[model samples]
Target: MTDYFWDFDGTLYDTYRGMVKSFVIACTESGFKVESDQVYKSMRRTSLHQTFAIFLKNVDFKKKQRIVTRYETVEKSEQTNDRPFKGAAEVCKWVIEQNGRNFLVTHRNKSALNMLKRDQFTSLFTGCVTSENNFPRKPNPASLNFLCDQYQVDKDNSFMVGDRALDIEAAHKAGIKGILFDPDDIIFVETVPDKRIKSLLKIIV
Candidate 1:
């Protein structure tokens, strides 16, 4: 059976709204004005860290840390705003029904699991690797490698599904197929994934 590795933000959950809003608020509170649309676009094009660099350019490291901390604080407090995209739960269930295993690999800390539990999705996963795992973030495959080794996963039949090129890169580095889930067709990445789908329901186990 095929195994799946999932990304939380933007992949399983439609979280960019809350994340972008919190980031904007944090930046504004820190005396930096930023456009939400631009921030969203940058985040889609790259990553949260890179997007912060784009907006927080010329800022000192300490101030950048403060804004990031503020963003995280606001985001965590407003976690109720994050929700799984349509078919996210269904797709995970489908994988299980097909005798496939589903695992989560996310940069989010334990909060990722908390949100999953809140959404009643915790039982759907065989395992998860979160920020607390301390594996290098994607496009590094350290976490994926760890999961594969720990679970005795068949890399040839496993896939990593995420919304960013870094996810695909990590999957490749881990010797697994990558599926790019770009529901809005807004992401542009040079790395070619094993497959690309605009919807979660399109995933074939």
Candidate 2:
């Protein structure tokens, strides 16, 4: 059975809107007005940290840190409002019904688990690796390798499903397939993934 390694934000869940909103609010509060579309594009192409670095390049480290802290606080406070994408739960359940397993690898801290629990998705995963684990962030493959070793995952049959290029790169680095879930068709990656689909339900084994 194939194992599915899932990304949390923008993959299984439609969290980018909330993330962008929070980021915009934080930046505006810090006296930096950013366009939401630009922020979304940057975030989708790179990461939150990179996005901050890109926008706050001229800001002092102290101000940047404050903005980041504020963003995190806003995001955490609105975590309950975030929801999984349509058919996300169905696709995950479909994998289990096919005797496959689901795993979560996210940059988010323990709050990711809290969201899963809140959404009643905690039991859907066989394993998870989050920021709490302190593993190097994705595209590094450290977290993926840890899960592969820990659960004895079959690299050939398994796939890492994520919305960003880093996820595909990380899966490849870990010796597994990558599935790019690009609903908006805005993401551009130099390397092609094993499969690219717009819907979570298209991830059939």
lDDT of each: 0.92, 0.93
lDDT string, candidate 1, 29-101, tens digits? 9888899998888887789989988888899999999999999999988789899989999999999998999
Q: What lDDT does model 1 reach?
A: 0.92
**What CA RMSD would you report for each candidate?**
1.2, 0.9
- Give me candidate 2's TM-score against the actual structure: 0.98
TM-score of 1: 0.96
- In Å, residue 180's CA in model 2 sits off its true spot by 0.1
Best by lDDT: 2
Question: Candidate 1 has which clashing residue pairs, if any?
Answer: none
lDDT of 2 at 184: 96
Instruction: Supply candidate 1's per-residue lDDT for 172.
Output: 96
lDDT of 2: 0.93
Single out the weakest 10-residue window by summed lDDT for candidate 1: 182-191
Off by over 4 Å in 1: none
Q: What TM-score would every model get versus the actual structure? A: 0.96, 0.98
Name the 10 consecutive residues with the lowest summed lDDT in model 2: 196-205
- Cα error, candidate 2, residue 193 (Å): 0.5
Per-residue C-alpha lDDT of model 2 across residues 58-115, encoded as one tens digit per residue? 9998999999999999998778799999988999999999899999999988888988
Backbone clashes for every candidate come to: 0, 0
